[model samples]
Target chain A: MPRLRATAIIPLLLLAASAGCSAPGANDDDAKSGSGPIKIALVDAQSGQLSSLGAWELKGARLAVDEWNAAGGVNGRQIQLDVFDDQGDPTTGTTLARKIDSEGHIAMIGTAESAVTIAMAPILKQAEIPNITSGQSPGLVAAGSEFLFLNGPTSTTYDETLAKYIVDKQGLKSIAMITNNGSYGKGEHDAFLKALSSRNVVPVADQVVTTDQKDFSAVLTGIRQKNPQVIFVGAEEVESGLIVKQARDLGITVPFAGAAPQGTPVFLDTAGAKNAEKTIVSSPYLSNDVSDASKKFAAAYKAKYNEDAELHGAKAYDGTQILLTALKSSNVATGKALADAIRGTKYQGLLGDFAYDQTGVGIFATSIGTIQNGKLVAVTG
Target chain B: MQVFLQTIIGGVSLGAVYALVALGFSLVYRTMGLVNFAHGNVVTVGAYLASTFYLTSKLPFALAMVIAIAVTGAIGLVIERVLRPLENRDFDLMLIGTIGFGIVLDALVIAIWGATGRAVPSPVQTEPIDLLGLRIRTYDLVVLAIAAAATVLLVLFLSRTKRGAAMQAVAMDHEAATAVGIHVGRSNAIAFMIGAGLAALAGGLVGPLLYVSPALGGALGIKGFAAAILGGFGSIPGAIVGGLAIGVLDSFTAGHFQGYSELVTFIVFTVIIMVRPTGVFGERTVNRA
Candidate 1:
C-alpha cells in the first residue's frame, strides 16, 4: 500500500509542476503567436489643457481601427490598439514611448504636438519601431530617424502660405511677429522670416514670448509702438487666445493670423467668439467639408463619442490608415519590414494625398480656415 | 489718445472679474489662515453648473447664476465639513489635501462632462459701444459694475451686521471669540460660503467671455492668487487694487513691449514684494498675548 501511494504522489507532483510551468509559457506563447491579432499603439495628450483635442484624435483612431477590423484586417489578423495618454508633456511622452516600445507594438501613431513628438523620436528609433506622428514639427523628420514619419505640414509650408496671404490678400505693408519661444515657435518664426525675405517684405518688429507666459502687455505695447498693419502669432491656442483677448483690451486692432494650433475650437472658447472671429488660421482639415472617408469616420466617431472629430482626429485616422496599409503590403510582420513599407507608402487620406519625401515629411497640401460665428469655415485651399 | 483711453477702460473691466476672484481668496485666507487652493476649482464648478442650467435646463441667465451660486456655496460647505476634521493638522498637510482635492474635482469634471469647451451664451447684449474711438463690448462694462456693487455690499455687511461682526471677531481671534460666546465653526462656515459665492459670481461673469473648460481655472487661479499676494493677503481693498494694477500692467506691457508681458509682470511682482514684504495694506504683526 505504501509503494502504491508513493507512486501516485510522485505522478501528481510532476503534473502539478508541469501545469505551473506551462501556464506562464502559455502566456508567452499567446503573446508570441503570429496567428493572433497585430497590436498597434497610440500615444498622445489625453488629459490636461489639450485633452479635448486629444480625445478627438482618439475617437478618429478608434473609428479607423473599427473600420479596418470589420473589412478584413491585415491578412485576416485583427488589429488591436493600445492607447497611452502623455498629458501633452514631452517628458511623459518619452516615458510612455519607452513603455510602449518594451511591450513590442508593431507600430505607433501619435503625439499631436511638435514638442512631445520630437522628444519621443529617439525612443521609437532606438526600439526600431516606425511611428507616424500627427505633429507638423519638421524636427521629427529632420533628425534622420529611419523609423519616424510625419503626417502634417511643416512650419515652412504654413509660413510660406501665411506670408503670401498677409501680404497679397490683406495688403499689409508692415508686419509685426509675436511668437512663443520654443522649438515649434522658433521654427515658425524662422520660416516666416524666410518666406517674407523671399517676398521682399520686412517685418517692423519681431518679438518672443516664453511658453509659460500668460500676460502679453509688454509685447503688445512694443507692437503698438511699431504700429504694424498686421500681427502674426506663432503659438499654441492658450497663449494665442490670451494674446488676442489682451490685444483687444489694449486697443491694438491689427488683424491676427496664426498657424494650425490657433484653428482649434479651444481657441474660440478660451478667447471668446468676438476675439476668435478676428483671427485667421491654416489647417489641413476642416470639420465642415467631409470626404467619403471623413464622413464615415465622423459618423462612427459621433455615434461612439457623441461629439464631432476635430483636426487631430482626422490626422490620427489618416496616420493609422497609412500605417495599416503599409503593414498589409509588407509580407514580413517585423518592425524593420513595417518601417520600410511605411517609407515607401503613397496613400490618399482625409487630410490630403500623403506621399512621404526622403526626409519622412508628408508631402501634402494644407487648407486655410477662418473662425466665423464660432465655427471653422474653409476659406481657401 | 482715444485708443489709450479705451485700452485702460478695457483693462479695468477685465480686472474687475479678477478682483472678485481675489476677494474670495483674501477673505478665506484672512479668516482661516489657510489658502484654499481649490478656490479656482470652485469657480470652475460654478461656471459649468451655470452652463448646464443655461444649455440643458433652458433656464434664464439670472436664474442660472443664482442656482450656480447656491450650488457652489453648498459645495463650499461640504468641503469645509470634510476638512473640519483636519483643522488642527499642519498647514502643509492641509494645503496638500486641498491640492489633492482640486485634482479629484478636475478629474471628476472630465469624467462626467467629457473634455470639451462648451459655448456659454452671454446674457448681456453683444453690441460693442463706441468709447471714444475704440469699441468696447457691453458685457465687460457690466462685469465692472457688478464687481463694484459686490465690493460695496460686502464692506457694508462686515461693518454693520451682527453676524458679520461675529465673523470678523472670529477672524481676529478664534479662541477669544469662542470664549466670548461666538460660534467659531459657524462663523468659518459662513465666511467660506460667502467666499464661494463671490467666486461663483466671478465665474458666471467670465463664462460668457471665456468658454468653461476643466483647465480654465488653473491660470485664473494662479493670477488671482498672485493678485491676493500683491494686495497683502488679508485685505479686501488690497485685492481689488492689486487686481486692477496687475490688469493695467499686463495691458501696458503687451501694448508697449509686444512679447515680454510675462517678464514684465514678474518684474513688477518682484519689485512690489521687495518694497513691501508685508503687502501694500497688510499690518505688521507683533507676537503678543
Candidate 2:
C-alpha cells in the first residue's frame, strides 16, 4: 500500500512541476509579442553549495523588476520575472534553458555559476533568448554566444587588475596559488597565472583542488613549505574562506589575494574576521558605499531584503537594469532585436558605466579592495 | 621532516573523523547485513543538530553534542524500523531505500537550516601549538584521543558484553541466533542506534574542521565508505586502521602532489581491493543464510 501510494504521488509531482514550468507564460501568444506581462526567467542555483549566489542574483533582479513595476513597467507591460532553481548543475541549467525558452520568456537573468551559464549558452543562443549572467569566468566569453551577456567584467580583467596591484603596486612577486578545477576556478587560475607571467612573477606553488573538497589542510601545508609572500586563491567564497582559515590555523600569517568572491560577507564570516583581514580583492563593485547611486541602491536593497549588498547583487542589479532598459528602448523587442538592444544600451550601473560590445562584455575594469575589520573597503594608494 | 610530521598529524586527525563515520557503516552492515547508505546524511544531521543546540540554544557544547547524538540515534532507530519491513525483500531494494532515506535527510537539512553554510565553533582553541617542532591544533589532538578511546571501548563492548555477543551471533547467523533465543530484532536496533550515535559524534567532532552545510555529508561520506571498504567492511578494528591509512595516504599525496591527491588515494584503494576481495581484516566465512 505504501509503495502504491509513493508510485501514485510520483506522477502527480511531475505533473505539478510541468504545470509550474508552463505557468509563467500562460498567455503564450500574447507574451511573445502582443499585450501581456513581459515574462522573463531567472535561473540559478536556488539550492546547494552555490545557492548563496542564487539568492543574491534573485534579490538583485527582483529589486530591479519591483522598482520598474512600481514606476510603470517597460512599455506599459508589468514585467513578470519567474525564478527556476538550476541546483548548480549544468544539466539542470540546460534543461531550464529549454523550459524558459518554450515558456515564452523573452529574456533570462542569472545562473551565477559559470559552468551552468556556459552550458545553457548554446541552447539560449539557438532559441535567440538574451541572457545576462553574473559569472566572471573567461570561459563564458569563450563560449562565444552572441545572445550571452556578462553582467560583470570577465576574470581576465579582474585578475589583471589584481595582478597589477599585487605585483606592480604592492611589489609582491613571490606568490603561490590554490584553485579548484571548476570552470570559475580554472578561469581565475589561468587569468591570474597569465597576469603573473606577464609581470615576470612565477607562483612558487600552484595547487588545483577538487570543487567539493572541504579539507584544505594538506594543500595549505604544501603551500606553507613554499613560503610565498602572498597566496592567490582562485576558488569560490566558502572554499576560499576555508583555505584562509586553515592557513591561519597553520600559522601562515602572510596576506592572501583573489578576485570577486573573496570580498563577500560569506567569505568574511566563514574565515572569521581576524583570518580574513588583509585579504586583497579585485572587483568592479568594491562596497555598497562606492557612490551616492550605490548608497541609494544599497539602502533600498537593505530595506527590502534586510541583508547587506555585495558584488554579485550589484552585478545582477546592473544586468537586470541593462536588460529592462534595452527592452524599453527597443519597444519590447524579442529575439535578435532584444539582443542587439542589450548590446547597444548604455547606462551607468552600481558597478560602473555599461557599454556592451559585440562580445557582450560591458565592463572591463575592477578596483582593488582589502578586507578591513570584516568589511571589504576600497584600497587607496 | 616537519612537513612530514604535520601531514601525519593532519592525516591522523582526519582519519579519526572518518573512523567514527566508518564505524557506523561497519556496525549496521555487521549486525543487519545491510549497508546503511543513509549513514552519511546521519553525520550531516548530527553536525547540524549540534550546531543548533550549541550555537543557537546556548547549551554547553558537550551537552549539545550528547543531545545531538541521542537525536541522531533516535533517527537511526526510525530508519531501522522503516527498513525492517523490507528486510525479507531484495537487497537492492534495501540499498535503494537507504539512498532515498539519505536524500530525504539532505532535503530536511536544507529545509530546516536553509542551505547556507554555518560555522561551527571549535570547543578547543583553533590556534596551533608547536609540538615536537610540528604545529597542530589542540582540537585535532582532542578528536584523535576521543576517537581512539571510543574505538577501544567499542571493541571491548563487542568482545566482552552479553548484548554485544548477541549482536555478533546475529551477525554470524540470524536464524541460528533467533533459534537460540537471541532477540535478533533488538540486536539489530541496538546496532543501528550505536552506529548512528557514532556517526553523529563524528559529525560533532569534525564540524569545526568543515563548515556545517548540507553538502558536507556527501563530501565526507564517500571517504568514510572508502575507509570502511579498504579496512574490511564490518570489521571494527579494520575500519579504524583503514580510515587512518587513507587519511595519511591522502595527506601525503596531497601535500606532495599538487593535483593528484584523489588519483593516488584511489589507485592505492583500487589496488588493495583487487588484492583482497574480503578487505584487510574481513573474515573468510560468509553467513548469507
Candidate 3:
C-alpha cells in the first residue's frame, strides 16, 4: 500500500511540474511579445434582432485575426478577442463599455447601433480605450472624443452624396422625404435637408415615423399629395421596403432613393424584386467592385462563410486590419502606443486608402449602388 | 387634414397588428391566469417559421402562413404541457420560467436565422388607393380587414361554441369546472394553442410590413402585455380597444414629438394604470379565501 501510494504521487507531481513549466513559459512568451496577448473586446447586438450584423462583424474580425496569425501575429503576440452582446440597448452598451474598459483590454470594437455607440462614447473616453465602430451617426464623432473612431461614413456624408446624386444627376427638383424618428433617422433627415439647402432645393413634404411602425399609408399619402419628383427614404431596410411597397400600392410611382442603411440585401429581399428594382441607395462599399483585392476578399469570405459579405462586414475586416497594421508598425504593445499607431495608419484597404483623421474617423472612400434585378449593382454617378 | 387622415390610417393598420398580439395575451390569461411572457417570442418563432417555409421550402405565402401557425400552435401546446405541472408553483417562479423560455426561444431563433433582420415580402402591392381624397396602401386596408374578421370569428367562437364555453368556464372557476366534466386540462391546452395561433397569424401578416428579426417580439411583447392590462387582463374587447388606442397614440406622438415618443407612450401607460387599477374593462374579482 505504501509503494502504490508512492507511485501515484510520482505521476501527480510530474503532471503538476509540467503544468507549472508550460504556464510560466506561456506567460514569459506573452511578456516578451508585449502584455501577454493583445486583448480586444467586441461589443455588438450579438443576441438581438441585429445579430446578423453582429455575426457579420464577428466573421470579418475573425477573418482578419486568422490572416494576421497566419502571416505571423502582430509583434509575435497572439490576438485575443472577448465579445459582449449589448442586445441593441444603450444602457446595456454602457455597462458593457464600463466592464470592457475596467477589464484592461488593448482596444474595443463595436456597439453596432448608432444610439448604443453614442451612449458608450463617454464610458470609452473615460477609460481612455480606443473604440472603432461601424455606426454611421454623425453624433458619434460629434461627441468630441479623439479615441472614438467611426469606421463608416458619417450620416451627413451619406445624405450629402445621396442628395447630390438625386438633385444633380437625376435633376429632380421637388422631393419628398420619409424618415424614422430615431437618432439615425433624425441625423439623416437633417443632413439631407442641409444638402438640399446647399443645392437651393427644399423638400415639398417630410414625414417622420417610428422604427416599430409597420404601416406607411399616411406618409405615402402625404408624399403623393405633394407630388414630389423623387422620394427619399431615410430609414433602415425593413421600414424602407414597407414604404416602397406601400407607396407603389398607393399608385405613387416616383423614383425612391434611400440612405446607407437601405443598401443591404434585406432591403431587396423584403421589398421584393418589383419594388426594389429601381430603388437607389448610397453605400460605402460594394461587393461587386471587381477590384483585385475586393474580389479576393469576396471570394475568400464566400468560400468560408457561404454568404455574400455586406459593407458592415467589410468595414469590420478593414477596421481589424487597420488595428493589426498599427500594432505591426509600432514596436511597443501598450494601449496608448496601439492607439497612436492606429491614429497614424495609412494602409490600403479593400474599401480604399484607409487613414484616420485627427478625430480617429476613417478617411476611407464611399460609393453608390442601386438595387437592380434583386442584387446590388454599383452605380457610377 | 391629409396628414391627420394618413396618420389615423397608419395608426389603425399598426393597431390591427397590436390587437392581434393582444388577443393572444388575453386568450392565454383568460384561460391560464398566468401571463406567458414568451408570447411575443412565440410570434417571432412563427415569423421565422413562415420565412423558412417561404424562402427555403418555396411554399406559397398562404400555405407558409398556415404551416407557421400550426407549428406555433404546437409550440404553445408543448409549453402548456411542460408548464402545467408547475401551475401550483409560485407566481414569480412561473413568470421567471416564461421569461427564461422567451430568452431560449430568442436565442434559438438567432441560431437558426442569424440575428440579422430579414425582409418579409408583403403579399400586397405598393400601389395606393384613394379614399376620401387620402391615398392609402391596399395592404393596410387588408390588414385592418383581416383583424376585424379574425376578431369577429373569435368572438363568435367563444360565445357560441361548446368548446369555447368550456374554456371560459375553466377560466372562471377551474375547480368548479373540473367538478363538472369540462376537462379543464384539455381546455387549457386548447386555449394556449389558440393564443399561439393568433400570435403566429399576426407574425405572418406583419412580416411583409416590417423586417423580421429574432428580437422583433421584445418591444411588441411589452406593448401587448400593456394592452392586455390596459384592457382589463382577460377582456377580449378591452384588449382590442386598448391596442388600437396605444397604436394611434404612439403614431401621433412619435410623429409630433420625434425623440420623446417612448417617454410619452410610457407616461400614457402610467396614467392609465393610476386612473384605473382594474383597467378600462377589467372586473374586480372577489377573493375566495
Candidate 4:
C-alpha cells in the first residue's frame, strides 16, 4: 500500500518540479523572501461540531495579527496567517499538521478541541517548530511534544480550582460531578475526582455522559437523590447547558460550577438566561469587567469584526501576541531558539501575567464568574 | 421508587419525540415503499425555521410553529418530487440519495444559522412539577399530549377518511390502488408532506429541552429509524410502540449504566434486527394469489 501510494505521488512531484524549473534561483529567493509576510498556520474545527469555538479562535487570531500588523509587522516582516479545518477529527488534524509542516510556516497556533491538538502533536514535534495550543486537555502537552506548547490554563487546573473553591471557599460538605466520556471530559472528571480526594472530600454523585447524549433528566434525577451542595460539569458548552437546564427542569436548584467552556455565550444561551443563573465557571480571561489590555483587545475586536470576543478567542489572541513579542525581541529566532524564547519570556496579556512552566504549560490564575441576566458577571479575579 | 418514577417520566417525554420522527418514517415507508432518510434533517430544518421566526424574528411561538411546519411540509413535497425523477428506484441508490439530500439540507441549515445550538422558550415553564413526590417537567407533559394528539389524528386520517382509506389501499398494493382510480403519485406526495410536518413538529417541540440546532437531527435521526424498524416499517402504532420502547430503554440505561447507555441502545437494536428483521408484531404474512 505504501509503495503504491508513493508511485501515485511521483507524478505530482514531477509536475511540481517541472513547475519549479521556471527560474533557477527563484526557489531560493522565495525561500529567503526578505520583508515578506511570515506564514503561520491555524488548525481548528471550521465546519464540524466545534466550529463555533473554531470561529472564535480564528477571529481572535485575526485580531492579534491585525493589531500587530497595524503597529508595523513585527519589526519589518508581516504575518501571513493561514487556516485549515480539522473538523475536530484526528485523521483530518494529522493531515493538516503534515501540510503545515511541509509548507514550512514559522509557527502555528490552533486546534480548539484537545483531541485534534493531541492528534497533531507528534507531527508538530517532528516538524521541530513552535506550536501553541489553547485546548483544555493536558494530553496536548503531556504527549511530550517539545514543539507543542499549551497556551491557556488546562482542564486539570480548572478542575482543581473548582474543587478547591467549593471545598475551601464555599465550605461545601459534598459535591457531584457530571461529565462526558470523551478525552476532554474524562480528563477533567478524573482530575476533579482526584482533587476532591486530595482535599479529603467525597463527592455524593459521579455521573458520566456521552458527547452526543442530550437528555440529562434521568441523570439529574439520580443526582438530586444525592443532594450535593453544588454540581460540577465536565462537558462542553451544549452538553453543559443541557445538563444545567434539565437539572433545573428536574427541580434541582443548587449552584453549578464548571470550566471555561461552561461560561461561553452558547452555553448561557442554550441553557436559558434564567436556568444559567448561579452557574459559575472557572476562566483565565476577564468575565465581565475588563482590564486595560482586555478593553483594548475587546474594542479592537468589536470595531473590526463587529462581534464580542469570547474566552477561546481571547486566549488565542494572547497566545498570538506572546508569539509576536517573542519574534520581535529576537531577530533571527527560529526552530529550537523560538520555542526556547517562548518558554523563557514572561508577558502580561489579556489573561494576566502569562508564562509557561518547564513542561510548556501556561501558569495562570483562575477567576470565578457566573451568567447573571445573560451576562458573565465576575465574582473573583 | 422516585428514581423509577422519574425515569419513566423522562422516558415518556423522550419517547414522544422519537415517536414523531418514527411516525414520519413509517408514513413514508408505507406510501413510497422506501425509507425517507431526509426525515431527520426535516426536523433540523424545522428547528432552524422555528428559531428564525419565533426566537430571532420575534414572532409569536404558536405562529412560528405553524409556519415552520407548513414550510417543512412544502420541503417534503419538493424532495419527494426530486426523488420521483430517478431512472432506477434501487433500494441502495434511494437510501444513499436520501442521505445525500439530508446532508445537503444539513449544510444549508448550517450556512444560514451557523453550527452552534440555541435555546427556544417552551409554552410551559422548564421547571418541574411535583406530582406525588416525583419530579416531572410541565414541558414533558405538553410534548406527550402533542404527540398523542398527532398520533390519534394520523390514525384517524388513515382509517376514517377517504384519503386515509386510499393510503391503506396504496400501502397494500400500489398498482391495484391506481387501477381503482386512486392517484398513487398524489398519495405519495401527501405521505411525504405528513411525514415531514410531523418531523417538524417534533423538532419544534424538542427545542426547549434539546435546544435548536442542525446537530439535533443526527442522533434523533438514527433513533427514529431504529424505532420505525423496531415497531414495524409501515405500522403507525409500531412507530409509537418502537419509540416508547427505545426511549424507555435509553432513559433506564442512562440511569443504570451511565455513559454506556447509547451503546446498549444500539446493541439492543442490532440484536433485534439480527433476530427479528420483521420487528415485533410487524406483519410478515404474504397473500396467496
Q: What is the DockQ of each candidate?
A: 0.20, 0.49, 0.43, 0.39
Rank by DockQ (best first): 2, 3, 4, 1
Q: Residue A268's C-alpha lDDT in candidate 4? A: 82
Model 2 lDDT per residue over B1-289, tens place: 7777777887888889998888889888888888889988999999999989999999988899999999999999988888887775677898899999999999888877876668876777646897765678888889999899889889889889999988999889898999999987788889999998998999988887778878777767888999988898988888998889888888887766656678878898999999997788877374232
Best by TM-score: 2
Best by DockQ: 2
Per-model TM-score, in order, reads 0.87, 0.94, 0.87, 0.92
> Residue A65, candidate 4: how far off, in angstroms?
1.3
Best-to-worst lDDT order: 2, 4, 3, 1
Question: Residue A104's C-alpha lDDT in candidate 2?
Answer: 73
lDDT by residue for model 1 over A1-381, one digit each (tens)?
123224434643543565476654353234335777776777877666666656667677878888889998888888877777788899999998887665556688887777888888888888787888877766766778888888777888888877777787777879989888777787888888888888899999888887655545456755777888878889877667777876775567766887887777667665667767757676777663558877876777778778777777788888888888898888535567788898788888888888887788775566666778878787754
Candidate 2 Cα misplacement greater than 4 A, ranges: A1-30, B284-289
Write model 3 residue lDDT over A52-73, tens digit each, in one string.
Answer: 6677787787788878887777
RMSD of 4: 4.9
In what order do the candidates fall by TM-score, top score first?
A: 2, 4, 3, 1
